[model samples]
Target chain A: DAGVTQSPTHLIKTRGQQVTLRCSPKSGHDTVCWYQQALGQGPQFIFQYYEEEERQRGNFPDRFSGHQFPNYSSELNVNALLLGDSALYLCASSLDLIQETQYFGPGTRLLVL
Target chain B: AQTVTQSQPEMSVQEAETVTLSCTYDTSENNYYLFWYKQPPSRQMILVIRQEAYKQQNATENRFSVNFQKAAKSFSLKISDSQLGDTAMYFCAFITFVGSQGNLIFGKGTKLSVKP
Candidate 1:
């Protein structure tokens, strides 16, 4: 019974560069959501993927995008990274859209240099 | 817009003592959910406890309990007989279903240090 897992525990990217962070949701779950936690701040919603399509997105700009695969894994991509993009990227998975509590991955720390 | 607020930024509790972290939220909806999540230095978010708006009885899990006052929009966590392992950043969160989507909103967090 593996929980949610994320890849590249940490990443460093320069301005104007692109980076991809991956997430494998907890077993027996199907919905994946992404969040960004900045230093000294709580996580802010990024977007969520359901049924391989984006359901709802937060106030993030178009530079942030993500994909949900058929296997329920997800990848968060950030383009033209700015120093402010540096934060902890978290992936949370739920068994369904409305009822179940979400399980989170350890998260990927993204450092935009 | 719904928002959760945790006023205490940092607090310390002597081991074996009790400490309560305060939280207040703003929302117009009558039905929703509130959660307290603990994040240790390792950064994995763990659910501590949760409360539903309509439930009158406070939610409790062993040494962890919540005082949920729906009318006052206040939800606070009380940890009894605190242990050093309880030290972590505690976050208050809000979520509500609208049609079918509910985005979790979290407060800045309260850092609790259970000192031995």
Candidate 2:
């Protein structure tokens, strides 16, 4: 069983540009969540999706959004990126929306210049 | 505010030695879940251990165990026989849900260095 996988291990974009990171949850998982980790800090929840609908969101702004597909894959899109948006974007998936153990991906390192 | 706190910013232990990382949490819910995740240089977040607040006995997974004090709202991780591979950033997290509004709250993390 392949674990969670993320695309474009590293990305570079200029300020005001839009970027989209992709994630494939572990096999047999249904829920996907996104998190942003700044340098020397822990990850903060961005949002969570299940059944192809966004179920919960964190304290992030409207610029950050996500979508979940029928196959359980998810995408995190950031609009009007800022230099401070340079951080590691991690995707985690669980069996459901409940408090289950979440499997995480290696994460996409976004560098906004 | 619901939060998790890791007071130690850094910790070190010699190979084969034991080390303890401290964590404290604040939450209004009586039943919740706690977790310890390890992030290495590769940037992959890995779950090391988990504990349920309703369980009285501490959870143990081989060399990793937790000392959970529900009354004090403390959850500390103890790593035994530390190895070089054990070096990583350890984060403590708390999760509580009312309906479907649950999200993990993670701490700043503690960098663990296992020396040779």
- CA lDDT of B69 in candidate 2? 97
The parts of candidate 2 lying over 4 Å away from their true place are: none
Candidate 2's DockQ is: 0.83
Candidate 2: CAPRI quality band: high
List each model's interface RMSD. Answer: 1.0, 0.9
- After superposing candidate 1, which stretches have Cα over 4 Å from the reference? none
Q: Rate residue B62 of model 2 by lDDT.
A: 98
lDDT string, candidate 1, B6-100, tens digits: 99999999999999999999998888989999999999999999898889999999999999999999999999999999999999998888888
- Tens-place lDDT digits, model 1, residues A50-78: 99999999999999999999998999999
| Candidate 1 C-alpha error for residue A70, in Å | 0.5
**Per-candidate total of colliding backbone pairs:** 0, 0
Output the worst ten-in-a-row residue range by lDDT, candidate 2 chain B. Answer: B94-103
Write out the backbone clash pairs for model 1: none
